[model samples]
Target: MIIEPLGGSYDRKAFSCGVLALDQYLHELANQDVKRRVRNCFVAADRDVDLIAGYYTLAASSVPITSLPEDLTRRLPRYPVLPAILIGRLAVDTRYQGQRVGSILIVDALRRCAQAAPASFALIVDAKDDKAAAFYCKYGFRPFQDRRLSLFLSVATALKLFG
Candidate 1:
């Protein structure tokens, strides 16, 4: 249950976890531009460093204020803005499926974002595909109309949703 920033010699093992546990479509997407976004990882281990439970990435990002619904924009202060991020990606490892590790990773992601990113308006992620979309949607994330693969959760909303 040890969760920390990704680094050290365990990267190869972690990336392999991503490649094998996540669908091919997601692995391919992660291999491209998305990798340049927020890339953070969480390692769950036993008494020894196993890097085995699961991991996910988080990065900063922005979406135009105009991309949000009119009501949301109006509710915000009158300045052009961008939503910020603590994106969740590469969320898998078959060895730990059904152990609720994914949920813990997400909770860690949100807590880190809320505590550290004051300029960030929301936590954003590009769900690898539809099934991922539903997973995010379950947590009060809303799909952006123009970007079908993307979803966002306002910091306030996310904190409340998870609490």
Candidate 2:
């Protein structure tokens, strides 16, 4: 499978991660978001079958230092807000579960963000649930004190893994 930018001809209907909302986003809103320059959505598709295997979206964002835990705040710059790239959503088709597709998509997202200009300091993701939070935690993401489901990983750390 290969990851590529979402496009007109890709098969979005056949993609389902067992979540109606996520599936609906791909089928109904992904293209529109792309056209409006809202978020950049990337899809993983099987080269032979041409079916979407998984996908994720990324957008520029920021986090207030005041919202972070004291330990984290101590290490960051004195600036009130820190630049970041948000992983708006991530899901893998149920058919491709346990195949590491989600991990691949995440690595791809981090690599893209790391190489983007006007560099961001970290990658942030809002986990839909505890399970999703665990998945991200496995990749070294830490939750802010105010929000357990909201996690972050520094760009420096991500680049060390994927740069």
Candidate 3:
């Protein structure tokens, strides 16, 4: 599958894939969030908009060095830097369900995130609900100890798994 960054118009199919109102709102907010870094909005296909399959967005964000467990933080070079990329949203259209589209989107996101490693410690995302949380958990994203809305995976771990 090919994944290309989408912009310049609203993506109704992507909104439908989100599966709920809040998720749709979140997808829309990404387009409106001016403080975010370049939001890579992906639209998967085989070189045509007619083949629009699924989409996701990626943006730069930071996690506190102190939010990480010592095992991960202790190995990093001493600095206050805590680079991260937020997988703001990922959703596969219902027509494409059960065909590994979600997995493709995730691996694509990880691959993109990996390209910025060493400078980044982890990839972070807020799963919209328990189901979305479990999907990410399967890929090794663990919830922050006290934050139900947040989850993260170390860049090292992602590279080893997705590379």
Candidate 4:
């Protein structure tokens, strides 16, 4: 199981995470996002086969300081917005669903966010559903005040976990 950038050699057409939107994104839109310099897509792929086990996208994002808990906001500068890295999308193929493929991809995404250039205060994800929210919560992600499905994990915490 190797994690790498999406490329021509990857079998994108055959990837199916059981979600139509996620499946369509890889086959039809991921390359566009990459080419436009908007988000970088990464895949957890088979070593011997080019099949993708899971995939995720990362991009620069921001969060309103007021949306954070008072305990957290009190420790930071009173900026209107804080820099963040967004995990735009994440999915594991049905064939790989129970094998921790999602786990592997998410951990990789968090590590990348933690080591990103120009610095970010946290990593954020807008979960697609309650199950997705629960999955992210397992990794210590806390919800934004405006939405339960929208969550974030501070880079400071990620550094501690990765280190």
Candidate 5:
């Protein structure tokens, strides 16, 4: 049940969340992304079984201010883009889906972004599908004006959640 940086001990090839792309990313690409400093991959790993229960990737990102709903942007500084953190991917092994593994991973991701060295105003995610989008909405993420599957939640709120 420990969520830590991905390492060689976990059986990457054994993870399958019913999505081919996500499964491939974890099996074939996550380590490269980490080594390239492009994204940080964290996994909920079980030491005894060498199994990965779930995983997520985080990276620095930005959002166009104009893409946000007017009600959300009207009070912000007029910068064209706002600094943010992207939860590039998140997936739970089918065996762990009903166990709140995804929720735990997202909370961990938000905590990291809230305490990041560089400031980030929000945390964003591009859902792979409508069902995934609904999971994020439970955490208060709002959709972008033009991207229904893309959503964001304020860092301030994340801070409040664990303050």
Candidate 6:
């Protein structure tokens, strides 16, 4: 499989992650969002076919320092907010669910965040459910105090893992 930016040629209708919202976003809004410069989306496609196997989106974001754990906050500058990259959406087509496509997409997202200009301090993900949160936790993401499904991984930690 090859990972590349979302393009007009991709067969979005053929992709389904078992979630209506996600599927709808890809089929309806993904290209428009990209055209508007709202978020950057990347898709994993089959080597020979114009089929999208999975995809993820990234955008600039911030987190309040006060919302972070004391241990994490104490080490950072006394700024009110910390810069971050939001993994806005991540989904694997049902046909590609067990093939590690999600894992590859996330790792690719983190690597891009780590290499982004202006430099991000962390990677944030708003997981859709408990199962989604658990998947992120396995990658060392920690839940924010305000929400169990909202999780983050420090860029320092991500660099160690993916740098």
Instruction: Please tell me which model should have the higher TM-score, number 2 or number 6.
Output: 6
CA displacement after TM-score superposition, residue 124 of candidate 1 (Å): 0.5
TM-scores, one per candidate = 0.77, 0.95, 0.79, 0.96, 0.95, 0.96
* Residue 45 in model 4: lDDT: 87
| lDDT by residue (tens digit), candidate 4, 1-163 | 8999888588799999889999999999999999999999999988687788889999999999988988789899999999999999999989889898887887898788876777899899999999999999988899998888999998897778766
- What's the residue-level lDDT of 56 in candidate 1? 68
For residue 8, give model 4's deviation from the true position in Å. 3.8
- TM-score-superior candidate, 1 or 4: 4
Tell me the lDDT of candidate 2: 0.90
Clashing pairs in 3: none
Output the number of the lDDT-best candidate. 5
RMSD of 3: 3.3
Ten residues in sequence with the least summed lDDT for candidate 2: 154-163
Evaluation by lDDT, superior candidate among 2 and 6: 6
For each candidate, the alpha-carbon lDDT, in order, equals 0.67, 0.90, 0.74, 0.90, 0.92, 0.91
Worst 10 residues of 1 by lDDT: 24-33
Stretches of candidate 3 exceeding 4 Å from the true structure = 7-15, 22-38, 46-49
Report the Cα RMSD per candidate.
Answer: 4.1, 1.2, 3.3, 1.0, 1.1, 1.0
Show model 4 residue runs off by greater than 4 Å: none
Displacement of residue 133 (Cα, Å) in model 1 is: 0.6
Clashes of 5: 0
Query: Tens digit of lDDT per residue, candidate 2, span 69-144?
Result: 7877787779999999999999999999999999999889888988898789889999999999999998889998
